[model samples]
Every structure is written in C-alpha cells, then in structure tokens.
Target chain A: MAVSFSRRIRSLAPVLVLLALCLVIASTNSNFLSVSNLIRLLSAAAIPLVLVMGATFVILMGSIDLSVEGVVALAAVAASMLVANDFTSLDLGFVALPAAMLLGGLLGLANGLLHVRLAIPSFMTTLGIGFACVGVATAILGGFTVRISDRTFRELTLGRLFDVPYSVWVAGLCVLVAWIIQERTRIGRWVYAIGTDEHTARQVGVPVERTRILVFALAGVFYGLGGAMSASQLGQGHALLSQGRLFTTITAVVVGGTALSGGVGSVLNSVVGVLVVIVLANGMVLMGIEPFVQQGVQGLLIILAVSLALDRSRLAVVK
Target chain B: METFREYLPPVVLVLLVLAVGAIEPGFLAVDNLLTVTADTMTLFLMASGATFVIMMGGIDLSIQGVASMTSCIVAALLPELGFAAVPVALFAGAASGLLCGIVSTRLRIPSFIASLAISGIVTTVAYWASDTRSVLIAAGDRDSFLAWAVGDTGPLQNEILVGLVALLLLGLLLNGTPFGRYVRAIGSQERAVVASGIPVERVKILAFTLSGLMAGLAGVVMAGRLGSGSPTLANEFLLPAIACIIVGGTAITGGVGSIFRTFIGALTIAVVRIGMTFVGVSVFAQQIVFGLILVLAVAITMDRSKVTTVK
Candidate 1:
C-alpha cells in the first residue's frame, strides 16, 4: 500500500510543481492569471508543445532525437518555398503542408535507418543528421527568408477558432493522436518494452528495429507539422527558423516527467510540462530577470529535473 | 581488418592531401600548407582534450562552451589583470569541467545531458560576463602579452608550435601514465574495472578537468589571435572538433584512440574545408559534407562488440 501510494505521489509530482509554480507566480503578479495573458502563453507554447509531443516518443524509447531544430528548419524552408512565396515561382497552395511533412518524414527515416542499421548511438546519429539537415536548409535558403504571402496558410497563425489559434488546435490534435498511439496501439507498447529492456523485448518478438525506425519517422512528421506552424506564425521561413528549439523541446519532454532512461511518462505529462516551461519563462520575464540569467536558470532546471526523474535502479551503470 | 582500420587515418590524410594538391597545386605550396596548419591549431587543441574523455567512454560536449567562456574571461580581465587573466581563465575552465564531472558521476546523470546543461549555464555566464557583446582585447595588451600567440617561431607559426607541444605533452600523458591506461580500460570495460577496485570516478573527473584545461588553452589562443572574445566565438568549433576525433579513426564507442590521431584528424578536416573551397563548393554546403563524413567515420570506426545494445 505504501509503495503504491508513494508511486502515486511520484507520478503526481510534475502536476504539483506546475500548480505550485502557477500559484506562486499568480500571487506575485495578478496579471499572470488573466485570460488574455493565458491565451498569449498558450500561443507561445503551441510550437514547442507540438515539438515536445513528437520528442516524447523518441525519449520514451530511451533514444533521443536532437534533430528537431534541423528537421523543423528544413520543413519550414521547404513549406515556405513551396507555397506562394516571394522567392520562387512555385506555389503549391494547401499541398505545401503535407509536402513539408513528407520531407520531414524522409529525413527522420534517414535518421532512423542510420541509427538502427549502422548501430551508431542515437544521440550521435541524430546530432549528425541534425547538422546535415541544417546545412541542407541553409543551402536551400541561400541566405534568405522565404516570406509566405498566402492568406489561408497564414490563417493557421492568425485566425481563431473559439478564441484559440489554429496552431493550438493543431497541437491539441497532435496530443490526441499521440495519446491514442500511446494507449491504444501495439507499437506504443512495443516502444515501452524496447526502452525498458531491449534484450528482453527482442526475446519476446517485439520487432525492436522496426519499432525504433517507425517511432523516429513518427517524430519527424510532428516536427514537420511544427515547422509549417512556425512558418505560418512568423510569415517567413529560413535556415534558422527553429533555432534553440532543440534544447527547449528536450527540456520540456524531460521536465514533463518523461525519463531520459525511457519507458515512462505520457503525452499528457509532456503537455503539462510544456505549460510549466512556458509559464516559467513568462513568469521570469514578468519578474524582470535578465535573458541570460533565464537561460542559466533553465539549464539548472534541466539538471534538477533529470536527476529527479532518473530511475537509478534500472541501470547497472550510468553512462 | 584491425590492421587496416589502424592505418586508415594516415592513409586517408595522405589521399586527401594528394587529391587536393591534384585539384589545386597551390594547395601544396609551403605558405598555404603553413596556413592550413595554423588554422588547425585551435581545433587540434580542443579535440585532443576531448579525445581523452572519449577514450574513457564518456564525452565532454562542454569543451566548446568552456573555450568560449574562458575566452570571455580572458578578454574581460585583460584590462585589469593583464597576463594574469590567462591562468585565471584556464582555472575557471577546469573548474567548470570539474562541476560537470561531479554532476554526472555523483548524481548519476548521463554525461551528455549533464555536459549539455552545464555548457548552457557556462555559456550564459559568458554572455553575462561580456555583457552579451564581443569584448575586444586592447591592441597594446595584445602586442605586449599576446605577441607569442601570433608571432612566428623560425618557420612555423607560434600557434602551430603550441599545438604541436600540446600534442606531444598530451600524447605522453595519455600513453605514459596509469591514468591513461585506466581511461582506456574503463572505456573498454567499466564494469570489470569497477569490480577490480580501481578509482574509476576519480580518473573520470581528472580526465574531464584535463579536457577543460585544454579547452581553456584553446580559448586563450583564440583570443590572442583574434584580440576579441564573445560567448559565441567558439560556437562553430564544436562540430569540427568532434569531426576531427571521429575522422582521425578514434572509436566513438570509447577506447582505442590517441591525441596524435586527433591531430591528424584536425589536419584532415582543415584540408577538407580548404579543398572544398578550391573545388568550388559553396561554404554553406561544406557543413553538409562534414556531417556526412562524421557519420561515415563513426560507422567505419565503431566497436560493435563493446556495446550490447546501441541506444
């Protein structure tokens, strides 16, 4: 009974932290709870929220995907250039969205293949792929931002449905899809099994390699969608469109109670984690903290969160 | 296969040199070759230190951040402390590495995550210290104290000479010392070493500290050459340095590498970059090539038998 009770407390820790943080910030600044500010906060979180949702799957398998920034940058640039843009004669209209996502899936497929086939560590493979993707994006960009002129595409960012941006709705849809995959699918269960114990999973016929590759491809799709949303929000896309997002998204997923060790945490946890991170950033700005200091604080927060969420007993060594 | 893998780096280096020389004869000229060597010094310094940690089956991603932070420290303190600032910066760099080592080992966090977080924090410190701008070292101080960095010694540039000396000393340290053997042993098989009652944690920490010191040295040299420092000054070095280690035929799986190999790797990278320019490849496209090369090298040199599961 005590073990189950303590486990319940541990599971609820992230929620409690989010609640406590909100109360503290709200008490310090009453405007923090205002509906307008809350909406702004959600909008600010939309892109990262989508990103975190994708990253959670990779992390759930105990493998990391550092290719988020690169995938997003490439997808964004591809989407912008394909649409009615200032740079080129090409205008694919609504087709640009799926096209961009397909590009991301291809890149993610490459990332998965390299890691699984070559047996390179996921971090190194993903990091290298990320760099390559960024380079490709830069090459395509030619040192220019492709501005989107299509009103319908821009509506993803500007138009509101029931007082929420379309981007947020997209993010909500991602959460719902991800939750369904996690709770209702065999691949989701296979991912947890592989992360929990690869040898055992392999023994039990979990199709480790295929599942790993598929998860990476799935992650790429979400990153592609995120890129499109970002391009819509900013009205332009460039090689640096998703700069600094690698750290932010990874931090969000890890802080949301997902262990870097894998096989723990959920889509809902990551969603709440995204909210926590965004609110923390917003609260820091309201408190007048320097931007540089805020980065340092986030850094410390990552270390603290990872240490707290780590499952030491599962490992014979912590490499 | 073992023998071929061992000889691959030097063979590749020679091939690259010949290929580049074939494409552009001027690439072989003494002056241009000297310039390439000089350009490789900073990367060589950073990668050599990282080689030690990599040999131990751990990695130090914070080297670039430490280099940038120390560069900021050197630039910020030059006005007040003059030559004294260099050591202080180096010490601070080592201290940061120490912190990373402590966090990873003591707290049981993975080295990559710990180093990444620490790098972010120190990079922030660098920004805060330099007021988020490039801090320039005064010309008077540069000529007086930093002259050794830019001045030529006989035929070779001072920076090249410094790099060579670092290569020699670090090579000796790794090959001649027990700590060096322990690093390899730990990397090759940590569980066995731990059971054998070796002080694995202490050695790991020392290796990290040494890596940090070398990064600091690289930063000081960079500041001396450029006469300025900023948080982002060494930002571009990270990938190239990692590329150097892997390309030089060092196993990313840990163990089975040397500082001299990293030096060769650094030269290979510099030559590749210069060669790309000679062949009319756009500067932006070079990174894509390097990324591809990095993956290829790791694939070639990885020790598959060591890791039971690749995560």
Candidate 2:
C-alpha cells in the first residue's frame, strides 16, 4: 500500500518518540547510554507496553479499557499464589492467571457485548467493568497479599536470553503477535474498519460485534499475561497492580502518537507509547526528581500529548 | 420512559440491599449500617460532585487524587490553618478540579483524558507533599477534627450531616437553578446549546468548578473520618465514587445522571459494600461483585440511543 505522508508520519510516530526520548535521556545522563540501562529501560517499558498494546486495540476501535489494572491485580495475585513458595504448592491463585484471563476476557467480552449488543456506551461499560473487577479482586484477597514462590515462573520472567531480560522477550513477542493480528488477520481488518466507522463497517459485512468481543477478550489475555508475569518479578499477588492502569495505559497510547479519536494507530504505536512513559519515569528517577512529582508531570504530559494528537476533524464532539 | 426508568436504579438498590440483608443476618444491624453509611458519604461527596461533570457530559477522574491530596494537605496544614482547615482543604481540591477543567475545556482535550491526567498529577503531588506518609492532624486540631468526624449533634454523624447538607445544596442547584437546566441541556447536546446562545464553555468550566468544590468538601469530610490525613485515605474511594454515580443511574455518556439518584446510589454502594462483608462474601468476591454490579447497573439503566457508540 502506498502510504500518504501523514500515514507515514503516523507509522513513524513510535520511532520518532523513542529517538526523542533517547536523545533526552542521553543528554540528561551519560550513563543512560550504557547497554545495561538500555536493556533495563526496555524491560521497564515492557510491562506498560503489554498493557498499552491491549489498550491500543480498544482505542483503535474507538473505545477504552479502564479494567486492565483491576484485572492485573486479580491476575497478579492469582499468579502470586501459583509460584509455589510460601502460600501453597497446590495454588489456585497460580491457576488464577488463566482464571484471571478468563475473568478479564469475560469482563472485556461484557464490555464488547454491552457495547455492540446492548449499545451501552463503551466509556460506561469499561468504567463500570473496571470497578466491578477491582471490587472482586479485593474481595478475593481481603486486601491482603498473595505471594508467589514458583521458581520456574520467576525464572521465566527474570531469566535472560542472550543478555536480554525475559520481560523484554515476552513483551517483544507480544508486540509481534499484536502486529500480525492487526495487519494480516480477517479480524484485524474488521477492527480497523469498525474504528473507522461502525455502521459502514457493518454494512460492508464486518462482524462488528464478534470483532469487538474478540478484541476485548484479546485485551484480557494481555492483562492476564502481564498479571502472571508480574508475579515472576514481585513473587506476590497484590490487587494494587491495576491501581493506576487507566491513566497509565491511556497516557502511553497517546504518547506513542496514537489518535484518541480511533481508526489510526498501530501496534508499534503502543510499543513507543510504553517506551516514552517508561523513559519519562526512568529519566525522572535518574534525575532524582521526587517520584510524586514525576507522576504529576507524567499525568500532565499525557493530557498535553493527547490533546495535540486528537483528530478533531473526525470527532464532531469529544466526550 | 425517562420518568419510570429514573426510579429504577434506586428501587433496584433498595431491593438489592433487602436481598443482601435477608441472606446475611448481620447486614441489617444499625451500628454496622452507620459505618457503611459514613463510608458511603465520602464517595457520595465525590459522586455528587461528579454528577455535575457527568451532566455536562464530561467526566472527572481527579476525585480520588484530589481527595487523597486534600487529606495530605489538611493533615500537613493543621498547625497554621486551624478551623480554617476546612476552607483550605476544600479550596485545594477544587483548585485541582479547576485545573482539570481548564485542561479539558480550554485545551480541547477530552474530559476523560484530562481528568485522568489530573488524577495522576494530584496523586503524585499528594505523594510528594505527604513525603509518602500520612500527615497527622496536630494535637490542638485533633479535637476540632473529631467534632467534624465523629461528633453527634443528634442522630447522624457530623460527616454524614455535611454530606446531606451538600446533597441538599447540590440537588437544589442541579434542579432549581438555571445553571442546573443548562447543565442538562449541555449533556443532551452541546452544540445545540451553543447554537441556542448558551455559553457552552462557561457552563462547562462552571460544571467542573462545581465538581471541584464538591470534591474539596468530600476531602475535608474524609480527613475528619480518618482523623489523620493520609494520601491513601481517600484513594480507595475513587472506584466506589464513580461506581456509586454509575450505579445511581448516571450515564457515563453524560447529560443523563442525577445527584439525587447518586445519593441513593451512594447509599446503594455503601449498603452493598458493608452488607457483603457481613453476609460472609469474601473480600475478593466483593470487589468482583462491585465490578459486576456496575456492568449490571449500566446495562440496565443506560440510555443506549442517547449515545451513538460506546467510547
């Protein structure tokens, strides 16, 4: 396909953002150039990247996901119990990752079902679902921690391959898979079409309802996977995993230059969005800026980035 | 359709509470009910505030951050501020809400993203200000906070009274005032209102300002309840506050939800939360139930034709 200059810019967005972040980090600290830190950066970016990848598909379809964080906490706590450490060798929480994924998928599936089937607005569906999911997670743990002790899963998350962290590998594979699904599959085409125009897409024979449900379910898999891997890193399941999920995922998506208005973005956009967010956090850490201030600044930056990138032409009014 | 459906959510909530109480004998107790009501008030403040924003079809995500920040601020400012603490804490929260509104309306960023940004900024600022610790209300100020927090002028707790007062004031403003009508009109159709010569921008800005004011009040009440200001004190209230509004029958798409319904919504949330614990529902299951209820609430009460698409 011949790409327009604008389309090219949209595609190049992630690279541009990554390069810009690199230059800024390099300028702020010479030590940022070290391969060790670079890998660490990639790893740090990976978690949010997985999350943003999940969110981007929803955003591309012109909706949102606020439930990932809640699901993550539920999933992470589930993962924590499974690692076979202090809690129990025969852990259901460990199996809870798939359960969490199923739960998350069901939640997302609900979001899509309510969205297309019942016609509840996407914003409302996800918001309500996120709350419900978090409430359930808290109920399960009773606000306590579920620790993971499985050496194998921990190694899977922490272990390195060819000097690369496992997190990076997992995140990279996810991105690749996401890209393939977005570009090559029939489902992918339906997704793009729906985001562009739900009615027109439906008229053109896209299974809008089926595609949306699938996309939301797909997002659940990421949240669940992220939750599961998070156990490897922390060895505990805490419902806190999803605390700032809505803000962070949306921020990363916009930072990667994805339009909040839907129909125009890529998996690479998510990769870059997550990278930029992590870069900002990591750079702030390196600069010794207070963590709280860093959060506030990141929040402000997200608003700024999205405002700039929003395609107002496509939106008669933004809600 | 609107008239009958308007009462549906509250009725459902009443029935749900009755159901929960019937299942678990412990849920019907007064002392337990009072505490739950107190907890509900904190979110009620935020929901009442958010109702204004929602009526304008704009959502505010800063309720949690502002509440958390105000708790920290009140605790930190106690030595110098004294009884003046109430105004200052409320001011701080509202200011944060105002900033969010400015970011959304002036910059043309959507309220969802704008408020999300504000939540981030406020949470961070609160974290920094509190030095990542809860700030204790000084000894001299402790009595005053107690009076506000636990004092009983009569049957209701002080904080609960304040919430009721807020509810009355906000309800009147939402129903009886021109501002209220404009808000509803804005929610129904922004461009139409603008075309009709209403100052859509000002209405929006004011809606957010009102939201901020309510959050500020909530923060103060929350501080009183905790008896010490901690950033995390009101952090947990975020989901519940929004949930209360949604479950109270407010449209996530905006222009349709009401503060009156949200009042009942807050009560519903409180009852569900406190009742579930007493009913022997596990905490994790409670969280799941909260999420599930929100879906159910929105599913049943939401006006789908009003919004052309989700998100």
Candidate 3:
C-alpha cells in the first residue's frame, strides 16, 4: 500500500505543481482567471503543444530530435508558398497542409536513416539535419516573407468553435492521436522496449531499427502539421518561423514528468507539461517580469524538472 | 587506414588551401593568408578548449554563452575598471563552467543538457547586463588597452600571436601533464579510470573550467576587434567551432584528438568560409555546407565500438 501510494503521488506531482502555480498566479493577478485570457493562453499554446507531442515520442525512445525548429520552419515556408500565397503562383489550398507534412516526414526519415545507418547518435544527427533544414528554408525564402492571403485558410487560425480557435482544436486532435499511438499501438510498445533497454528489446525480437525510423518520421509529421498551423496563425512564413519553439517543446516534454532517459511518461504528460510552461510564461508576463528574466527562469525550470524526473538508479553513467 | 586517418587533417588542409588558391589566386597571397590565419583565432580558441571536453567524451555547449557573457562583461566594465575587467570576465567564464561541471558531476545530470541550460541562463544574464544593446569601448581605451588585441606585431596580427601562444601552452599541458593522460583515459574507459582510483570528478570539473577560460579569452579578443560587445557577439561561433573539432579528425566519441588537429581544422573552416566568398557561393548556402560536413565527418570519424547502443 505504501509503495503504491508513493507511486501514485509521484505520477500526480506534475498536475499538483500545475494547480499550485495556477492558484498562486491567480492570487497575485485576478485577470489570470478570466475565461478570455484562458482562451488566449490555450491558443498561444497550440503550436508548442503540437510540437511537444512529436518530441515526446522521440524522447520516449531515449533519442532526441532537435530537428523540430528546422523542420517546422521548412514546413511553414513550404505551406505558405504552396497555399494561396504572395510569394508564388502555386495554390494547392488544403492540399498544401498534407504536402508540407509530407516534406517534414521525408526530412524526419532522412534523420532516422542517417542515425541508424551511420550509427551516429540521434542528437548529433538531428542537430545537423536541423541546421540543414534551416538553410534550405532560408534559401527557399530568399529573404522574403510568404504571406497567406487566403481568407479560408486563415480561418483555421482565426475562426473559433465554442470560443476556441480551430488551431486549438487541431492541437487537441493531435493530442488524441498521439495518446492513442502511445497507449494502444505495437510500435508504441516497441518504442518503450527499445528505450528501456535496446539490447534486451532486440533480444526479445522487437524491430528496433524500423521502429526508431518510424518514430522519427512520425515526429516529423507532427512538426509538419505544426508548421501549417504556425503559417495559419501568423498568416505568413519565413525561415525563422519556428524560432525558440525547440527549447520550449523539449522543456515542456521534460517538465511534464517525462524522463529524458526515456521509456517513461506519456503524451498526456506532455500536454500537461506544455500547459505548465505556457501558463508560467503567461503568468510571468502578467506579473511584469522582464522577458529576459523569463528566459532564465525557463532555463532553470528545465534543469530542475530534469533533475526531478531523472531515474538515476538504472544507469551506471549519467553521460 | 590508420596511417591515412592520422594524416587526413593536414592533407585536407593543404588540399583545401591549394584548391581555393587555384580558384582564387589571391587566396594564397601572403597578405590574404595572414588575414585568414587571424580570422581563425577566435574559432581556434573556442575549439581548442572544447577539444579537451570532447576528449573526455563530454561536450560544452555553454562556450558560446560564456563568450558572449564575458564580452558583455568586458565591454560594460572596461571604462571604469579598464584592464582589470579582463580578469573579471575570465573569472566569470571559469565560474560559469564550474557551475556546469557541478551540475553535471554532482547532480548527475548529463553534461549536454546541463551546459545547454546554463547557456540559456548566461545568455539571458548577458542580455540583461548589456541592457539589450551593444556596449562600446571608449575610444581612448580602444587605442590604449585594446590595441594589444587588434594591433599587428611584425607580419602577424597580435590575435594570431595570441592564438599560437595559447596553442603551444595547451599542447604542453595536454602532452606534459598527468591530468591530460587521465582525461584521455577517462574518455576512453571511465570504468577503468574509476577502478584506478583516480579522482574523475575533479578532473572533469577542471577540464570544463579550462574550456570556459578559453571562451573568455576569445570574448575579450572579439570585443577588442569589434570595438563593441553584445549578447550576440559569439552567437555564430558554436556550430563552426564544433565543425572545427570534428573536421580536424577529433573523434566525436572522444579520446583520440589534439589541439594541433583543431588548429588545422580551424584553418580549413576559415579557408572554406572565405573561399566560398571568393567562389561566389551565396552566404545562405554556407550553412548547408557546414551542416553536411559535420554529419559526414562525425559519421566517418565516430568510434562505433565505444557504445553498444547509439542513443
């Protein structure tokens, strides 16, 4: 009973922290509780929420994907240009969304292949790929912003259903799909097995290499959808479209009680993590803290969260 | 294969210089070569320090932040403290690195995440210290104290001389010191080092401190050269410095590299960067080239047998 109770509390810790932060922020600023502000907060979290979901899977496999910002930037640029846009004559409309995601998936596939085939670490592979993606995005943009002029496409960001933006709904659907993949799929089980112990997983007949590749590709698809959402939200796209999202998304996944060592936490945990980070940022802004200081707080927060979430007993070496 | 791998970096350096010189004859001119050597000083400084960490099978992503922060400190304090600010900045850099070491070693966090988070914190501190703008050195100070960095002595720039001196000292330290041997051993076999009863944690901390000190020195020289400092001063150096280490044939998995190899690597990067301009490659495309080079180099040079799983 004691062991189970302690385990239950450990699982509930993130939610407890979130509630505590909300209550404290609400006490300090009454407007933080406003429904309109809450909606605004949720909308603001829409993009990062999507990004965190994708990163959660990669991190779940004990491999990191630093390609989020680059992939998102590329996807955003591609989506902006492919849809009814000022930069080019191409106008695929809704088709542009899937097309952008396809590009992202391809990039993700390359990342996985390079990591697996070459036997390079995932972080290094993703980091290099991310840089290359940024370069490609920049080259394609040619130093110009591609603005979405289609009102119908822009409605994905602007239109509200039950006072929540369509982007939020899209993010919600992604969360559901990601959660389902995490909890109800054979690939998801393989991801956990590999992350827990790759040699053991392979010995148990898990298709480790294929699963790793597919997980990265899956992450890319989410990043691609995120790029489309970002384009819709801002109604424009450039090479820097996904700036700073990488830090926030990774931080959110870690903070939501997901271990960086992997095989722990779930999609729902990342959702809560995204909300925690978003709420903290919003609350700090309302409290008149300097934006620079907020960045420092976030840095400290990640360190603290990772330290808390880390299970040190399983590893002989931390590095 | 072993002999070829050993000779690859120098051979690549000579070939790159020859290739670029062939395309742009002016690139080989004595004056242009001196300029390229001087241009590589900052990257050489950063990469040489990072080489030690990488040699120990760890990495220090905080060097860029440390460099930027130290530059900000030097720029902000130069008028009042003048030459004293340099040491202050160096101390700050060392302390920042020490913090990373403690967080990683004591808290048992991975150095990658620890250094990355610390980088964010230091960068913010830099932004706050500079009031989100560039801080300029006074004209009087620039001519008086800062001349040591920018002024040329004989045919070589003072910056080049500074880099050479640092290289010599670092080479001596790596080859002539017990600490150096321990660092290499720890990187190659941590379990063996621990069994040998060596104080592994202290050595790791000291290596990080050395990395931070070098970053600080780079920042000071950069400030002197630019005549101003901002939080973004070294923002572009991180990837290139990593490129320098890997392209120079330092195994990214650690334990098989030298500062001299990084020296050659830095020159190669400098040649490639400047040569691209002469060859009319778009500035935007250079990043792609560096990224591809990093992946390819790591793929080629990685010690695959070091780990059972490539996480």
DockQ of 2: 0.64
- For model 2, what TM-score is found for chain B? 0.93
DockQ of candidate 1 relative to the true structure: 0.69
DockQ of each: 0.69, 0.64, 0.65
lDDT string for model 1 (B34-145, tens) is 9889988999998888898888878788899999999999999989998898889989889988888888888888988888888888888899879999999999988777
lDDT of each: 0.88, 0.77, 0.88
Candidate 2 lDDT, tens digit per residue, B27-133? 66887667667767878888898898987777887787788888888777777777776778788887888888888887788887788888888788788767899
When sorted by DockQ, best at the front, the candidate numbers are 1, 3, 2
Arrange candidates by TM-score, highest first: which order? 1, 3, 2
**What ordering of candidates by lDDT runs from best to worst?**
1, 3, 2
Query: Considering only N, C-alpha and C atoms within 3 Å, which residue pairs clash in candidate 1?
Result: none
Off by over 4 Å in 2: A1-14, A91-107, B9-39
TM-score of every prediction relative to native: 0.97, 0.92, 0.96
Cα-based RMSD of the predictions, in order?
A: 1.7, 3.0, 1.9
**Chain A TM-scores, all candidates?**
0.97, 0.92, 0.97
lDDT of 3 by residue, A1-319 (tens): 9988987887898999899999999999999999999999999999998888889999998999988989999999998888898899988888878998899899899899989988888888888889888888888778799989978878987899999999999999999999889889999899889889899999999999999999999999999999988998999999887877888988899889988898998999999999999999999999998877766777788899988888899767755
How big is the positional error of residue A297 in model 1, measured in Å on the Cα after superposition? 1.7
lDDT (C-alpha) at residue B74 in model 2: 78
Query: Stretches of candidate 1 above 4 Å error?
Result: none
Query: What CAPRI class is candidate 1?
Result: medium
Per residue, candidate 3 scores C-alpha lDDT tens digits across B1-311 of 87898899999899989999999898889998999899889889988888888888888888988999988999999888988888998898888888888888888888888887888888888888789899998878877777777888988899899999989999888888998898888888888898889999998999888888898889888988888989989975877888899899888788888889899999998988887888898877887888888989998989888978998
